[model samples]
Target chain A: MRFWQLASFGGFLLLLPLILGLNDYYIFLTTLILLYTVIVMAWYFIGGLAGQLDLGAGAYHGLGAVVTGYLMIYYNVSGWIGLVLGGLAAMGVAFIVGFPSFRFGLKEVWYALASLGLVLILQKIFLLWTDVAGPLERYIPFREFDPLYMRARAKWFYYYITLGLLLITFYLAHRAKRGKLGLYLVSIRDEEEAAEMLGIDTRRYKLVALLTYSFITAVTGGIYASMVGFYHPILFDGWIGIQTATIAIVGGLGHFWGPPLTSVILLSIAEYLRINLGGTIPGLHQVIFGAILITAILFKPAGIGPYLESLIEKVRKR
Target chain B: MDLLIDFAISLARNVVLGIMMGSVYALAAMGLALLFGVANLINFAHGEYVMLAMYMAYFFSVTLVIDPVVSSIINIPLFFLIGLVTYFLFFKRVINAPPLSQIAVTVGVVVLLRNIALVIWQAEPKAPPFTIFSASYEMGPITIPLDKLFATIISITSLILLYLFLERSKFGTAMRAAADDVDAVSMMGIDTGRLFLLTLGISMMLVGLSGSLIMMYQAVTPTSGLLFGLLSWAIVALAGLGSIRGIYLAAVIFGLADALASGMWDPRGREIILYGLFILILWLKPRGLWGRR
Candidate 1:
């Protein structure tokens, strides 16, 4: 993390609390953004840094939400315990899916399809598992703004929780990027053959990246489910899978702050477009979303993150 | 003995239905295989191309009172041109980029094209006017829809034609050679770029044909491409990477599995079985059942 990044983090943290008091809608939107940022950051671990196109985050997210929501609703489990257990459950699934994928040489398109298949499979399971979670919606009981219970009245409570998770992710991501694991993962990502030849346990490191990323994303999913007070099988959706990948890519691969930065800009624009034109024009937002991706790929293949970083570096040199 | 006879009869029905459905899948998978072989690109937008062809067939039938089958025939040349233009404009730019970028570019095409269709046509399911042989045919206890029989016949004929083209034609031989070794074919003075463009064009034309074949039975919708697209993905995976014969066999198997599962349980259960089988195949045999490394 650089001075600018730290400064920005500090600035956002300081400003967010003040902004929360202004309006409920702003708080709700910011809270959603914060949650997505956590997801995008988790996605960056495997997608941007490890260089794997695992589209299975939605699988983990849905798993975490289902597990946590189920436990809290039926077993009366505390949201805190549910959060950890949800993460573990998702991690377990990540191993089941990621083990063969990495152990064998499933790279690029195959990996993507495999991950996507996992999401669909999980969604089907949840949809059909009527004894547990079915096509019907499941809701969590809400309490009066109780942060300890993870049941909050005001949206700001969820905002703070998501912010805390974001900070922890930022710290972990920052450390990994600077440390040895980051180098190993990056080497494996850039060229798996050369990395393996150089004695790097490419499969093991890829598994580690996947497991860690899955755990954090699941925890966030639990938080999201609690905040929304409901869960559905569609929680394991293709849209979120695409959105997370898009954010990571648009943020620019291999940049720590890229996903978060892209999340704020792109998601805000998407939300704005949805609100304004969504009523009149069906599928219009998707058209614009795709257009943005095409423009990004055509013009800035390196991504907005690296572009911003270089710009800052030039300014500093001057 | 009665119970046993009933079960046997049901199984036979499913098997026959599966084969019919599988033939359609094979027809779609052939286009995907051709593109993958010649261009080494999976064309995620292949489904959208199919969707566009269906829409074209629908409008042509609705406005001009042409038969759906004939409209699809007319769509082939236009779809081929669209494929060529899309490649030159979008896919050509990302031919050398990493797989993620390649996937992203195609995904963008999927979103753009699908949404564009939505904007133009709305989300309503549309079909041509009623025609003869739209009802089901009964043979003993087994019943098969007439539209499905026609679709299966058309799809099988197209696959056979594709097989002959690849086996006998000069351009087909060139495409096969390029699939095997791009550089070697280029060294032999073949214009690989034009070959790729031609491959994409033909691939789109085939998908358009497949779309029209199904238009007689299946209602055309903007989002129908997504389901068929994923189904084709599963088919391609099951068929292995570049094996045309394997695609046909795999498509039959997939079609059979879908029919049997839905018949035995429910429609949703069929999806679970199909996707479960897909993941299992990817895990156990990444190269597919018949594909060599």
Candidate 2:
């Protein structure tokens, strides 16, 4: 029964684009949902399994966007090539940022502060780096909505691209979940000192997790830049990083499907609120998001993932 | 030779200005350090409380026709109540939770406070209609603004008063005891819970006073809390977790660095230098400048 439920859920998502058709607004929203789901899944590796409360989503995502923007604008590179290079750039940055923090034992609050500071530093750099990226929004040219380059008039091309990214990320996440690296990561997250005492190289495994997470998130950032048709330094916003953190926490940390599911529900509500009441009543959606985050943290720290898992267990017992 | 003399004079001016700004930063850091020492929690929403106090000071001056100086005094108790209420409502529950949970709670508070401020104030930067402190006193080539000077004086006086309170008062001793060991402090027949609340209250009061004092020279915006909040964190981190005197010293260093950066480079350059300093300190000396391992 549980297997069937999972299968049906997957089927529903696979059919979602076809069912929604070419309604640009709904398609755009779905593409955003898929994009964020991929990002949040990447976050789960470092934040969930590794037990590192990293707020450096902006660090990788922003870097990827900037790299992609720079490549496409300056070198006349293809957005598809930018996608791979963008992920690599973000991974490189993650290594640089994560190495020092992990090496020096910056965990929990200290780590969070460092990561947040990293994003701020990156933003300031981009803002001041007038040679490559000035304060102005750099636009990506679209040749009558070229889908191959990701500058499409119709949302379908981006939608499929995001869907592909989501599938690949979800597959990788599943492989990690059932693999040796996943076990090591969870143990390290639960008790790092004990894991180290037990002869696990926590630092190496953490770097691996962080690098993988950064690479995938960077790809999403690259695709996001092309989808949006422009790039700005504000893409590395700390608030967006916090939002990703909220999704990971609320989705049930360490749960493979939790982040994506949480993103779907929460991001949908947020977008709906924004579209409906944004002009009529400003800041209400954010207030709701804040209140929900607080309540979830206080009341449901285990998130919907554990609740669902428990329900499955009860059904199996019956 | 003339170019070098002009550069030296400008550098001197920046150093003086930096010291003045550093006093304000110290005033803010004092509250944060007190909270960390006693509460053992880093309030990311520290700047939101400061923002609230600034708005209150602004309202008092604009609506009730009260002087900001007098209104700031009134803010002490009001903000103390605010702190006490906050403790009971949100903080007390998460006091024993994991560090990440504590952080999430505070981040939630930040989002809520910042957005609420945006809704109420409509995101417009506001300043009180008073120019008394805007006057500058010049000594040859160097000019010091009166508002900054007044702010520095107020901050120093508050710091001295705070020092005396912690040293001489009964509750202050109890608060210090609580910080040393919660179980032992409670075992000594002192109510540790009340002491924690008192510490938090005092911290909030200090933030309140600093916020009001800053309104004379700085404009208060809903988003201004982000920069101030991050700076205070940097100061606390650089100063060490519990050392009050270290906070003051670090704040001065931060202010001087910021002043020099802004004078020599640009405003954006100042932020880069400051955040870089914060990261470097965290890496090199996680125990901070004065914190004992």
Candidate 3:
């Protein structure tokens, strides 16, 4: 029965674009929403599961982007290959930074700040490394339709790709949640000192979570770069990391479906507001976004996920 | 021989400039340190407040046709009130909340304040044309702009005044006592809640003063908050919780880095030098250079 529900949800998303006859604009919007959803879902590893509150999603995302974009632009590598390479690059950097950070026991605000600072450092590096990505926007080759290269003019093509990635992400997140890794992470998050006392080798487990999260986030960046057909140092956006964390927290941290659900709903509202009220008031949409976040944190600190799970439990009981 | 001498001169010139700029940075970081030490609140929105104060400075300066520094008379009191209101409305609930929830609330403030600024200012960098000290004078081969000079003087003076207040005043003792032991302080017939209110107020007042001083020469952009925010954190990390003097020294070191980076290296890479230093410090000496505890 649970399997059927999951399959139906997957099937619905697979046919969403076709069923709605969403134009290119809508597909593009949905794709943007899904891309962020993947980032927030990826946050579940280090943030929700490990309780790290890692805010450096932009660092990994940007690394993935620059590597993939640079490989495709300069080396003529297919984006499929670029995407894999991007994920690997992100994982490698995560390990390098994560090893020291976890070893030093950088937790709470210090860890968050360090991660946030990483985004700015990487952005500046790319900006100054003029040969690869300077202050200027580097354009990727735009093809009318090239599936072989993962370049396409149609928006749905990228939408389907993003959707496929999102499904894989869901599966991975599900597997991770139910596994031994998940059990270790729960202990590490709730009681780090206790977990360490229990001989959990907390640092390695945290690094593993960081590496996994970074790899998935980097793939989203690669897809983003190809879909947009351009990349810049600005792709290394710290705001995206902050927003991803916000969405995850608002969706109810630690829940499998919370982040993705909140991501889609909130992003759709943001897009609607951007279209309707953006021209007149400029930041009306974002102001509403901020209000929603604050209210959620204060009133429903458990997040929307717990309520959702309880409802599902009742239905099962019935 | 000439090129080498010229290099030495430019390097010396940058050192002088960095010290002056670092003074103002000390003033900015001081507020954050106080908020951290006293309130125990990790204010992610510290830079946003400074950004908003810059806007306030611009608003007052433009309307009154006065120097931006003069606008502190209004900005300080106004920000103090804003601080009190925020303490009551937002911060009071999160005093004992976990760092995660505190961060969430403050990050919420960042989003709200930034977007509010965007709505009001429309992303354009606002700079009032009024300048009280627009002259520059030469001391040997190094030149110092009078505007920056006055800004530095004002910054150092404010730092001294705040230091004195913390050392000499009755409430200052109470605030310090709260920092050391909030429950014990409250047990001694002191209102720690009011102390936190004042602490937040004073912290915002420092931000107001720094904003006015910064507006002496620089323009206020929406993104300016992010830059200043990270800068304050970097300075605090470098300074630790030892003393105000540490904050000053660290800010100056940061200023020199800023000066050297922009003057000697690419101007765009300054953040790399600064935040790179911040991460390194976090790894090596998370207790900071002057940290006593």
Indicate which candidate wins on TM-score. Answer: 3
Reference-based TM-score, model 3: 0.97
Per-residue CA lDDT of model 2 for A107-182, tens digit only, reads 7877887888888889999999998777999988876776566577777788888888888888888888789999
* Residue-level lDDT tens digits of model 1 in A1-318: 699998996887767857567576777777777787888998878987789988788888998899889998898887888889999999999998889888777888778777877888888888899978999999888788666667777777777778888889988988888999999999998888999999999999999899999999899889889988999998987667767886788788878887789888888887788778778998898789889987786678788899899999999999
With candidate 2 superimposed using the best TM-score fit, by how many Å does residue B275's alpha carbon deviate from the native? 0.9
DockQ of all predictions against the true structure, Cα-based: 0.66, 0.72, 0.83
| Candidate closer to the true structure by TM-score (higher is better), 1 or 3 | 3
- Against the reference, the lDDT scores of all candidates come to 0.83, 0.84, 0.89
Candidate 1 segments whose C-alpha is farther than 4 A from its true place:
A1-9, A316-318, B65-67, B123-131, B220-222, B241-243
Estimate, for each residue in B1-293, the C-alpha lDDT of model 1 and write its tens digit: 99999998889888988888888878777888788767888677777878888888888878888777877778888889898899887888876577677787787787788888888889998876754557898999998888778888888787778888888999899998988888999999999888989998888888888877778767888877766777788888887756677888999999999889888677787777887788778777888777754
DockQ of 2: 0.72
TM-score for every candidate vs. truth? 0.94, 0.96, 0.97
What range of 10 consecutive residues in model 3 chain B has the weakest lDDT sum? B126-135
Reference A-B contact fraction recovered by candidate 1: 0.60
Candidate closer to the true structure by lDDT (higher is better), 2 or 3:
3
Point out the worst 10-residue segment of candidate 3 chain A by lDDT: A298-307
**Top DockQ: which candidate number?**
3
Q: Is candidate 1 or candidate 2 better by DockQ?
A: 2
Docking class of 2: medium
